[model samples]
Target: MIGRIRGILVEKTPGQALVECSGLGYEVDIPYTTFFHLPDTGQEVTLHTHFAVREDAQSLFGFASRLDRDLFRLLIKVNGVGPKLAAGILSGLDADQFIRCVEARDVNALVKLPGVGKKTAERLLIDMADRIKQLEGQFVPSAGGGSLPEGAVKPVTGSVSDARDEAESALIALGYKPQEAAKAITRVAEEGMSSEDLIRLALRSMIPTK
Candidate 1:
């Protein structure tokens, strides 16, 4: 089992990365949270990894922090939540916010994200409250955070990969093609932005004016 990877980051996209170690480049799927925190290509990075093996294929999932990896593992244990949805949840909300939503039983907030529904939100609340507390107790939020836990506070200043991914998906769900949304959001980020800001900017980009 590959527990961790420390190597030169060769390439990074919204949901994946290629890390080269000892002449072998390993492609590892990652969540937006991890994608946002990653260093530029060619820099050394360390990632916690989960190795999943099926009859036909082997896959590796990576996380920027231990909390993200732990949450990913816990998410898959919930009924009706697959790896993709788990990644989506992490992409949509940070760990601290997610825990609060579960604790408060906020089905509305949970359903706001793509793919999650009321039933799934209720199940998540019922199935995850206890585990959320356990994980929260173990993590220490970084100083200066308003409410976000340190374990969940991914860097967003320099890189917009994660923000871009979320904005693109949000735009597509609102009625746009995959490529169109991605390009528009990338433009928004390049001009200086956050996910919320990108959402607004992308909306303008999508408008057809005479």
Candidate 2:
């Protein structure tokens, strides 16, 4: 039931962050998008958080924006997506672009994301489009640099991998074969592009129809 936390950011990684609150340190998993926006270590920061509890495990997931957290919740409802995959998806694709892909039934776009396949992308569009609209109504992006402590290493390679995965999933979701999607994503990745940037580049690589 811990909805938010405000504290000193102590550490950060691709999918994790630690915040010092009330003389205690808490670790939270985060998507790449959140990591990308994080501030330097030792800064005061605030995050919207979701607490997941199970018989054997308790974990916190943080988002820079409420929209990101909402999307994370929605993604976990998909048949094969887990918290890790959901984090990966959100890290790779921004909320606005993801909503557009779903609305357009762009399986190509969906398949381009890491861990998303053709069937999965199709399922997401068919099963989740309406839900996206509902969530969109409540969306508000966070306003400042992300809450990260000082000396956090920039996860550039991680970001690239996230982008490549998303781009591949999107290509498949958009109707390209899985093999094609993989190939396109690989080519885009080779160009030293970010995930969002790779998505754009991969789209251009699609075979142009007469």
Candidate 3:
């Protein structure tokens, strides 16, 4: 189990990052929240990671904090929740937000996340409510405090269309049909929105309050 990684960030996208450590470049699957905190390419970065292995493939999922990584491990244990879905959940909402939703029993918020439906939201509320307690001792960055280290490379800005494309791709990755993803993005999108903003808004549009 590769629990953590510290290396030079080589490349990054909305859903993945490449970090070089010990002459080996590791492609780590990451949530958008982690993506938001990534340092510029060629800078040092570290992530708390979980290595997943199956008969056919191996994948590394990483998070900005130990709490998020631990929470991710708990999420995948829920019935019907797999690694991909668990990653999607963290992508849409960070560990802290998700824990708050569960504590508040906010099914509306949970369902709004990509790949989560009523059933999944209910299951998360029921199952994760207790599991989240295990993450209590780990350090959790405060809201909006998950940025890269001081003096690290500044984040690269993208155009509105790039944001839309990223949001659409994220939605598709979470099992939404491409057409559905496109439609949702189009509905809530505005000029100058970031990919994270577009995705957040699009998700809210899809899952309405009861």
Q: Which candidate has the top score in TM-score?
A: 3
| Residue-level lDDT for 57 in candidate 3 | 90
Give the per-residue lDDT digits (tens) of candidate 1, residues 102-195.
7767787777666788899888989998777557654574566644443333453343557677777766754457987888777667645656
Candidate 2 or 1, higher lDDT: 1
Residue-pair clashes, model 2? 32
Per-candidate TM-score against the hidden true structure: 0.75, 0.67, 0.79
**How many clashes does each candidate structure show, in the order listed?**
2, 32, 0
lDDT of 2 by residue, 69-118 (tens): 77788888888877777876776565665776777777876776667888
RMSD per model, one decimal: 6.5, 8.0, 4.0
Cα TM-score of candidate 3: 0.79
Evaluated with lDDT, which candidate comes out highest? 3
lDDT of 3 by residue, 148-204 (tens): 222222345455456788889888886678998999999998888888677767765
What is the descending lDDT order?
A: 3, 1, 2
Q: Give the range where candidate 1 is weakest over 10 consecutive residues by summed lDDT.
A: 201-210
lDDT of each: 0.73, 0.69, 0.80
